[model samples]
Target: MGAEGKTPRMTSHDAAGRSDDSDHRGYLDGQLLIAMPVMGDPRFERSVIYLCAHSSEGAMGIIVNRPAGSIDFPELLVQLDIIQKADQIKLPENAESMKVLKGGPVETGRGFVLHSSDFFIQDATLKIDEGICLTATVDILKAIAKGAGPKHAILALGYAGWAPGQLETEIQDNGWLHCDADPDLIFGGDVEEKYLRALRKIGIDPGMLSNEAGHA
Candidate 1:
């Protein structure tokens, strides 16, 4: 899960033959994806995903709303040898309350850190947007354990991945609705309310949504 290699650069072309940032080319990068009511996959039902990267190559995101049951951050630190059992009670306030989420179905054993831009590690962090960044190395975890990490963050086990054009096709098929992302929406403690909150952010009432896909 170490992100030590060179990060892939993704660019997009505009109509006038000009190149632009992939996120600005109508892609869902750095946005929140709200699973449609008719979602067929049980793994993603009512999921609220924060897209970290989206380009012609593929798309990658973390499910921010699904808690990784039975996983506790302090215990995880002890397991990883970042701290000892006796140190659990001494964890900082943010570390004590930090969430552990099931990012997605892929690479479930690995860890990904979706955090605020206040902290960074050279070559290990991918700045997703103005306020968010993704780091898949254990270094950030050590920082968090030491109370030297970002202002806000969540540790996700695994991530959602799509092949080239696969996500675009899903979007065209009405599998998702995307909207701008905010720190509160991404890092809030209300896990069960994220899906509904994301829908409301897109100006849709959850109670009014139907299972007809496009009718939402």
Candidate 2:
């Protein structure tokens, strides 16, 4: 799930329009989705996703805690033409330190940037909440290349998608648990800790979480 082109940005209306309808049913926009041990989909096993948009129509999220193994940030910058291999050394600390993640099982060829609300691009950035924004445009990449981007960001290749009623059904089947998003858990450098930490956020101890689904 790797591609280099114009990043696809979500519009405010597209991401925010369904909130009121979803709030009534407990929509999970801007929350963390922690895959349960019983998650049948191996692709999502032990994954932690940041729900970017959720509605009765469907849901979309980026895997916040899964790293795209062997994919380094600077190397990706060069591959995407956002920077030259020779110029990688000149990147600022935050830019150089950005993490590349395997966002999910969908659109594995595209890229999405989940970032702090401090940076924005008119009509290109979707403000998901008070502290988070989603920008898929290349300008954010360029800004990060120059160390001028958001203070914290995660560059995810691909995303997780669900059909209408899919996510809710999974939850009912004991396939996932969700909690309020924490900046550290979303943008932090520690990929391995996110899953367990997310479970803990909901007052669940990972060890105690059963891996079996039940109907009773």
Candidate 3:
């Protein structure tokens, strides 16, 4: 909510975020997972995920394109007591306009912040890549509320998760496609355009892609 307003408190339906880092990194850390049109689950249809950690234990990521429609960043800060409702006018531009996304299908009650590497908190931030980082602690939220946080960030409630080998099997089944992460794609303001844009990033025409999963 940077220069826009305070972050809004998430309602029951808005919950869906939380994450932990994995160093064992089997594969997919710092990658983008684009949902296939044939994706069986409606919840993840056309979703774009920022894979933070993946290994034999499982995988965890935040859905970058799914916004918590009813939640606002600045309003959230006020609800969490990080800032007074009257002090909202004092927030920096980036802080007020920062977006809040619906991260994934799990834990839909907590919060996670995925941001640029320019900011970090000791033992709190999980560096996902050279350009991206993730922080779930309230301290970062406090910093953002005070206008002293990362240069770019998206707050998400909940996260998507997969059990051991679950993601791999899904990919084999064509449930998702993989690609390198790009800042514009990850932190872009256009939520509705992300799905189509991501497909184009990998040189695929979304309009031509079929819903039936295939193996080549």
Candidate 4:
């Protein structure tokens, strides 16, 4: 059900940002935020994200499968100054081309990698969990340039972050539905149906969803 709070403001700057989305708080880390089928918010409709961090203060997640419009994989590498061979840019065989995704509306120039924790950025890597890891350092980019990165990976140009209590309020208000995230859902699935599919993963039929949430 929607919370007793108001919709949080979308701020422009990081430091200047403040949030009111939290009337409640907690993390659904490693969980999936599946967009409700009736959602009309352009930013989140039909989106599926993996919650990486959460607390009473705020939350952050990575949108795994939404490709940034008109932007292909190899083109993203070149934009990031990573050179790829013409013969290998779109190699016919097996190679996950360097690509970019529309992570969120927050930052348009930043990049983040959401991959299995089985791959680490050396020893000092910040591990999210036993199954997932996030490496933002340019070294990881360099590793990707050399094709030495993780087995399954998604490159997001931006991210989705909510302020303290913001995410909680949304959940309480039912802005998003929760489900256990699947690797296939995040890395190799059709994003067009990902939200609905994720809901199904948890046995929640999308047809049962209603835009107006209520506490019974």
- Candidate 1: where is the Cα deviation over 4 Å? 1-24
TM-score-wise, the better of 2 and 4 is 2
Q: Clashes in model 1: which pairs?
A: none
Give the per-residue lDDT of model 2 (tens digit) for 1-216.
443442433223222223345244588988888888788898899999889888988999999888787777788778777788999999999887899888887877677889999998876788888999988777788888987899999988889999999999999888887888899999988899988888888887777767677422
- Write down the lDDT of every candidate, Cα atoms only: 0.81, 0.82, 0.82, 0.64
Q: What is the lDDT of residue 12 in candidate 1?
A: 23
**Which 10 residues in a row give candidate 3 its minimum summed lDDT?**
1-10
> Model 2: which ten-residue window has the lowest total lDDT?
8-17
Instruction: Report lDDT (Cα) of residue 200, candidate 2.
Output: 84
Q: Which digits, one per residue and each the tens of the lDDT, describe model 3 over residues 1-216?
A: 221232333332221243444455459889999999777998799999999888777888999998787778878888888889999899898988898888877876678889999998766677877999988878888888777899889998888999999999989888999999999998899988999999999999877888766634
What is the Cα-based lDDT of residue 155 in candidate 1?
87
| Candidate ranking (lDDT, best to worst) | 3, 2, 1, 4
**Which stretches in model 4 have alpha-carbon errors above 4 Å?**
1-26, 37-40, 84-99, 122-124, 214-216
Q: For residues 188-209, what per-residue lDDT tens digits would candidate 1 score against the true structure?
A: 9999898888888778888888
TM-score of each: 0.88, 0.88, 0.88, 0.77
Point out where model 2 deviates above 4 Å.
1-25, 214-216
